[model samples]
Target: MKDLLLVLPRLARMIGSLLGDREVPLSAKVALGAVALYLASPIDLIPDFIPFVGYLDDLLLAAIVVDGLLNYVDRSLLLKYWPGGAASLDTAAAVARRLAGWVPSPIKARIFGGRRHTA
Candidate 1:
């Protein structure tokens, strides 16, 4: 719980940094916008009516989006934007990849930034 608490702020900062970066690809920006829109709108792939599973769609989509966003984002850029240790960021990235492991590489490639960020 404590560790989870530590992640959110840094995560927000890193995401903000990524969004502001001119080098980040347009596709990633678009995808992030789409996700935000989807989450804000009342429409869900799985309606939010079911008991425990109602939010599964949101969770799954979030994971996929995170994966798409993180996978192509230059590691160096991530490190630069990160407020915490590299190991923590790497762990978070690994968790993201594992959560979206079933997604195909080809499709993932199409979803996010392609250009590597230069230090």
Candidate 2:
């Protein structure tokens, strides 16, 4: 419970950072923002007074958002901004690549999606 509260922000940041890019659809961006704010709030669907089950709803919500958004969000952006999570992301990508190499196409499409460059 205490641990969940502490890590919630980091999880939200990772989701936001991963989804924060021009290529990301407006709807997805909005949804991600909403979820982030919801997670950061003191109140929740399962009230904190409930003890063990209090945080379940939040965890479920985050999981759903993360799972749904993972396909749409540009993961490279996540790796760049959230360096600690980057290693795990890289490892996952590597495993995915190795296991699914037979399938075609590149997955590095948004390596720079979150950046704002000057001309």
Which is the leading candidate under lDDT? 1
lDDT tens per residue, model 1, 1-119? 36545765787687778888887777777877787788788998788888768877775566677777666666777788899888988766666677677777766666664443343
Candidate 2 lDDT, 2-118, residue by residue in tens: 644444466556655656556655655666777678978997888977987897666555544443444445565555555356655554444434433333323222322333322
- TM agreement with the true structure for every prediction: 0.79, 0.52
For every model shown, the clashing-pair count is 0, 0
Model 1 misplacement above 4 A: 1-6, 113-119
Q: CA lDDT of 85 in candidate 1?
A: 85
Looking at candidate 1, the ten consecutive residues that score lowest on lDDT are 110-119
* Top TM-score hit: 1
